[model samples]
Target: MKYDWILFDADETLFHFDAFKGIQLMFSRKGVDFTQADYNQYQEVNKPLWVAYQNGKIDAHELKHSRFLQWAEKLGTTTMELNSAFLNAMADICTLLPGARDLIDSLSERAKLGIITNGFEELQDVRLEKTGLKKFFEQVIISEQVGVAKPDKKIFDYALGKMNYPCKSRVLMVGDTLQSDIVGGINFGIETCWLNRHNAEKEEGLEPTYIVSSLVELKKILIP
Candidate 1:
C-alpha cells in the first residue's frame, strides 16, 4: 500500500445518509405525517445552514438547532429534542454504501483506517456500531468535538495529530464533497480521492488526486 492511512467522510461516501427519510421517520414517531412538501420545506431551511456550517460561519450546535427550530416550535419541542430525534432516526435507517465493507476491509489490511466527518456526534457512533462496521477504523473524528469543520485545515491537523502526525503524502482522504473533502485535503497537503458516484459536475478549480464512481472502482485503484 502506498498510504499509511486512509480517512473517509461518513455520510454519502461510506453510508447512505437519507436526511429526508430520517426526518420523516422522526416525525412519524411524533405522530405527524411528514410529506414531500414537508421535506422540501425542511431542505429550504436546512441546506443554507449546512453551507454556513462548512464555511465556519456557524458552529455545529447552531447548525443543528437552527435547521430544526421551526419544527421544534411548531411541535412544542426544544431544538435539542428535535435534532436528537432526527439523528436517532437517521441511525435507525443507516446502511453502508455498496462495496463499503469490502473496500474498508481490503484497505484496512494495507492501511490504518479512520473517519473524519462534519456529521453530528449523535449519529456517527451509533450508525457505525449498528452497521457492524465500527471495528474497521482507528479513529472517528467528528467536527462537533473538534470545534472545526472540514475545508478548514484545523480539523485535518487534529486528525493527523491523532494519527501521530504521519507523513501527509501517505494519508489519503476519501470523500464525496468537492469543497470540504477535496479542497480541504488538497489544502492540507494530502492526496484525495473523490467518490463522485453520481457523476456530479466537477466544481471549478477543485481537483482531486483520484476520482471514482464507486467504492468498487476505488478498490481497483487501491488494491488491484
Candidate 2:
C-alpha cells in the first residue's frame, strides 16, 4: 500500500445514512405517522442546517436543536429530547455500505484506519460498536467533539495530531463529499480519493487525487 494511514468519512461513505428512515422510525416510536410530506418538511429545515454546520456558520448543538424545533413544539417535547431520539433511532438502524467490511478488513492489515466525520458523536460511537467496526479504527474523530467541522483545516490538523503527525504524503482520505472530505484533505497537504458513488458531476476547481465509484473499486485502487 502507498499509504500508512487511511481515513474515512462515516455517514454515506462507509455506512448507509437514510435520514428519512431514521426520522420515520423515531416518530413511529412516539406514535406519530411520519409521512413523505413530513420528511420533505424536515429536510427543508435540516439540509441547510448541515450546510451551515460544515461552513462553520453554526455549531452541532445549534444544528441539531434547530432542525427539530418545529417537531419539538408539535410533539410537546424539548428539542434535545427529539434530537437524542433521532440519533438513537439512526444508531439502531445503522448498516455498513457494500464492500465496507471487506475494504476495512483488508486495509486494516496494511495501514492504520481512522474516521474523521462531521457526524454527531453519540451516533458515531454507537453505530461503530453495533457494526463491530469499532475495533478496526485506531481513531474516530468526530467534528462535534473537536468543535470544528470538515473543510476547515483545524479538524484535519486535529486528526493528524491524533495520528501522531504522520507524513502528510503517506495518508489518504476517502470520502463521499467533495466540499468537505476531498477539499479538506487536499488543503491539508494529503492525498484524497473521492467516492463518487452516484457519478455526480464534478465541480470546477475541486479535484481529488483519485476517484472511485464504489468501495470495491476503491479496494482495487489501494490494494492493487
Candidate 3:
C-alpha cells in the first residue's frame, strides 16, 4: 500500500445512514406511524440543516435538536429526549455499507485506520460498536467532540493531531460527500478518494485526488 493511514467518513460512506428508516424505528417506539410522507416532511427540515452543518453555519447539537423539534412537540417530549431517541433508533438500524467490511479488513492490515466524521458522537461510537467496525479504526474523531465540522480544516487539524501528525501525502481520506470530505482533505493537503456511488455529476473546483463508484473499486487501488 502507498499510504500509511486511511480515514473514512462514517455515515453514507461506510455505514447505511437511512434516516427515514431510523425515523420509522423511532416513531414506532412511541406507537406513531411514521409514513413515507412523514419522512419526506422530516427531510424538508433535516436536509438543509445537514448542509448548514457541513458548511459550519450550524452546530451538530442544533442540527439534531432543531430537526426533531416539530416531532418532539407532537410527541410531548423534550428535543433532547427526541434527539437521543433518534440516535438510538439510528444505532439500532445501522449497518455497514456493502464492501465496508472487506475494505476495512484489508486496509487495517496494511495501514492504520481512522474515522473523521461530521456525525454526532452519540451515534458514531454506538453504530461502529454495534456493527463491529470500531476495532478496525485506531482513531474515531467526531466533529461534535472537536467543536468544528468538516470542510472547515480545523477538524482536519484536530484529526491530524490525533493521528500524531503523519505525513500529509501518506494519508488518504475516503468519503462520499464532495463538499465536506473531499474538499476538506484537499485543503489539508492530503490525498482523497471520492466515493461517487450514485454517479453524481462532478462539481467544479472540488476535484478529489481519485474517484471510485464503489469500495470494491477502492480496494483494487489500495490493495492491488
Candidate 4:
C-alpha cells in the first residue's frame, strides 16, 4: 500500500532500550552494587511516574527527580550521588536500534517520516541527534512537549496536524507497544504496524493492520 506519511515510536522501535538497560546495570553494579530486585523496583516506580507525566499530572523534572529519589530511598543510597549516576549512565548509553538509521534513510525518500514518542522532549531530541536519526524526521512530536500521551488519539492527531496531512488511509503508525501505537493509530483511523521485536503474544481485544519483526520488514510492506 502507498503511504503518504509514517510515524515511528522512539524507544524500543528505533532507540533500543535494552542497550540502555545494560549500561544502567553495569554502572549500577559497579558503582552502587544494585541487585536485580533493585533495578526491577526502579522500573516499576519509574514507569508509573512516566505515565503520570504523560497524563499531565506531573512535570518532567519532578518525574525524573522523584523517581531517582524514590529508588535511592528504597536502596538506602545517597540520593544526590545516585541521581548523578543515573543521568550519567543514561547519557553514556543513548544508541539506536539495529537497522534504525538505514531504515529511516530508506523510508524518508518514499514517505514523510516523523516520530511520536511519549518522552521528555529534550531527552528524546538529544538521543535522536546523538544517534544521527534526527535529520530524517520531518517533525518529532514528544508527549512532554505536547502535554498528552499515546492511546489518547489527540497525540496522534496532533502529529498529523503538524504534518499537514489529512487523517485518511494514507497514513501509517509504526511502534512496539500495542497499547500506544496500535491502539492510538487504529483510533485515529490510520494503518497500524506492530513491531513485535520479541515475538510476544498479542492481546485479544487489540489488533494491528500489520506485524513486523524488524524495521527492515517495513520496506517489504510499504510501497515506495
Candidate 5:
C-alpha cells in the first residue's frame, strides 16, 4: 500500500475557519459589545494562548478561559458573558471546507483515516459532529485530550502509538499549517502534505513533502 494511515488537521485544513471569522466579528460586535480595537486585541491575546497551549504550558480550559478573561478585561466586559458568546458564535458558524466531505469519503476506502488536531477536545468534537465529518475518521486525537500539540513530535508519536501500525513509512500528515503539520510530521519521520488553500508563499525553514491547492487533489497523489 502507498499509505496505511492518513492523519489530518482539523481547522483550516478540513474546516473553513476563515468563514467563521466574520461571524466571530459579528458576535463580538453584537453579543459582546466589542469594538474593532477590542476584536483585534482578542486575536492578539488568543494567538499566544494557543502557542502556550501547544507548548504544554497551559491546558485547554485554562487557555480558553484565560483568552476570554483577557479579552473581557480589554473590553471591560464580564468574562462569563464573553465566553458564552464566543462558544455560541463558534458553534453556530463552524463548518467544513469545500470538498472536505467528498475527499474524506474517497480516501477512507483506500487508507485508514484519522484526525490529529491541536484543538480543544470538546469544541473539536462539537464541530466535527455538527459538520457530519466525524464519521469518516477511524480515530480522532486532539492535543488537549492527549496533552501534546503539533510541532512538538510527541503528539505525532502519540497518534502513531494509538494507530499501532507496523509501517511508519506508510503514513502521511496532511494539514494547512507549515509550522505545525509539516514540522511535526518531519519530526515523526512521516511524509507531510500541505493543504495550501491560500496560495501563500512558503516561509523559510518549513517544508512539506507534497503540496496541493485543494482537497480534491489528494486523490491524485494518494490513490494514483
Candidate 6:
C-alpha cells in the first residue's frame, strides 16, 4: 500500500445508504405508507439540512430533529424519537457496498483503517457491529461527537489526533462526496480518492488525488 492509513466515509462510500428505503421502513412501522412523493417531499427539507450541516451552519441535533419535524407533528411523536427510529431503520437495513469487504480486508493487511463520517453516532456503531467491520478500524470519528462536519478542517484535525498524528503524506482519505471528503483531505494536506460511482460532474476548482468509478476500480488502484 502506498499509504500508512486509509480513512473512509461511512455512508454511500463503504455502505449502502438507502435513505428512501429506510424512511419507508420507518414509516411502515408507524402504519404509514411512505410513497415516492412523500420521499420527494421529505428530501426538500432533508437535503438542505445536510448541506447546512456540512457547511457548519447547523449542528447535528438541529439537522436530525428539523428534517422530521413535520412528520413528528403529524404522527404525534417527538422529533428525537422519529430521528432515532430513522437511524435504527437505517442500521437494520445496512449492507456493505459490493466491493467494500474485499477492499477493506485487502487494505487491512497493509494499512490501518479508520472512518471519519458526518453520519450520526447511533447508526455508525450499530451498522459497524452488525456488519462485523468494527474490528478492522482503529478510529471511527463521527462529527456528531466531534462538534464539526467535514469540509471544516477541525474534524480532520480531530481525526488526525485520534490517528496519533501520522505523517500527513502517508494518509489517504476515500469517500464518495467531492465537497466533503476530497476537499477536506486536500485542505488538510493529505491525498484523497473520490469514489465517483454515479459519474457526477467534478466541482469547479476541486480535483481529487485519484478518482475511481467503483470500489473494484479503487481496489485495483491501491492493491495493484
Query: Per-residue alpha-carbon lDDT of model 2 for 144-198, expressed as tens digits?
Result: 9999999899999999999999999999999999999999999999999999999
Which model, 1 or 4, shows the larger lDDT?
1
lDDT agreement with native, every candidate: 0.94, 0.95, 0.91, 0.77, 0.79, 0.95
- Give the clashing residue pairs of candidate 2, or none: none
Task: After superposing candidate 3 on the true structure, give the runs of residues whose Cα lies further than 4 Å from its correct spot.
Answer: none
Candidate 5 weakest ten by summed lDDT? 18-27
lDDT of 4 at 38: 66
Instruction: Specify the poorest-scoring 10-residue window by lDDT in model 4.
Output: 18-27
Where is model 6 more than 4 Å wrong at Cα? none
- For all predicted structures, in order, the TM-scores are 0.98, 0.99, 0.97, 0.83, 0.87, 0.98
Off by over 4 Å in 5: 19-30, 73-81
- TM-score winner between 2 and 4, please give it: 2
The best-first sequence of candidates by lDDT reads 2, 6, 1, 3, 5, 4
Clashes of 4: 0
Cα deviation of 223, candidate 1, in Å: 0.3
**What lDDT tens digits, residue by residue, belong to model 4 across residues 75-191?**
677655565565445545777777777788888888788889886565676677677877889999988677678877788878888999655688888999988788889988889
Clashes, model 5: 0
Expressed as tens digits, the lDDT of each residue in 1-224 for candidate 1 is 88999999999999999888888999999999999999999899899998999999999989988998999889899999998888999999989999999999899888999999999998888988898889999999999999999999999999999999999989999999998999999999999999999999998788899999999999999998
- Candidate 6 at 108: error in angstroms? 0.5
